[model samples]
Target: MLRRLELLKELLLLIPLGKVTTYSSLASLLGTHPRAVGAMLARNEDLVVYPCHRVVMSDGRLGGYALGKEFKRRLLELEGVKFCGPERVCKESVVDLKELLS
Candidate 1:
């Protein structure tokens, strides 16, 4: 794996199985920029193992996925983490990551 992706793997493992995380969150934890996380995910090769679906927008927007937004939604749907409330905020807990936490 590339250096960035290797770090991304470790960061991904920090995400809970049934919860959704964000690119920004992962980037912060990895001590990189949010765009860097997005770039790394854009190149993700093993979807079934890494479960990239567990990553989404911070506001529960579902954002973009390697395959497509529909894929992202479908993936999360399978994980049982639904968006709720007026804002459609996800009920699943997201680890609040800081830019310098790493």
Candidate 2:
């Protein structure tokens, strides 16, 4: 289980700057529940290396962030992610899970 969580963090590194993936997307890749992905993300201690902020909800919602949603939004914005609303990320900024598998 610990190893899987570590793998999840490692996967986060694959998300490019200005792009985002969803908890469900990572869960599908890992054969785990999306909640498990969220749980592992909550425990992430090394934000710089893990880049957990790039993960969002399937509907493009910001979801939870260890550093607070606003900070996460700021970070994503700095990376050129455009929001569709106050909390939803623009769909164009989302990366498909298939892109990560390769």
Candidate 3:
């Protein structure tokens, strides 16, 4: 499980600039639960290196960040991630992890 979490972290690092993904999508790719992905991200100590902020909720909601939701939004904004509304990211800007790994 630790190894898998490490792999998930590595995969997260591969999220290109300006691209974002959902916890559910990542869980599907990793063959784990969305909560597991969230747990792993919550425990991630290296924010910049791991880029956990790139992961959002399935509904495009900004979701949780260790720093803060506002900070996460700012970081995503700097990377060119667009929002659908005030709280959710634009679906067009989301990264498809399955296609990405393929």
In terms of TM-score, the best-performing candidate is 3
lDDT of 1 at 32: 79
Clash pairs, candidate 3, are none
TM-score of each: 0.78, 0.94, 0.95
Instruction: Report backbone clashes per prediction.
Output: 0, 0, 0
RMSD of 2: 1.0
lDDT of 2 by residue, 1-102 (tens): 988987887788888888999999999888899999999899988988889999999999999998899999999999999899999999999997767677
Give residue 33's error in model 2 in angstroms: 0.8
lDDT of 1 by residue, 1-102 (tens): 377788787667666766767877787667778777877887778877787777777777766678887767666667676767423337454555442244
RMSD values for the candidates in order, in angstroms, are 3.5, 1.0, 0.8
Model 3, 1-102: lDDT tens per residue? 898888998889888899898998889988999999998999999997899999999899988999999999999999999988888999898988888888
Better of 1 and 2 by lDDT: 2
lDDT of each: 0.69, 0.91, 0.91
The number of clashing residue pairs in model 2 is: 0
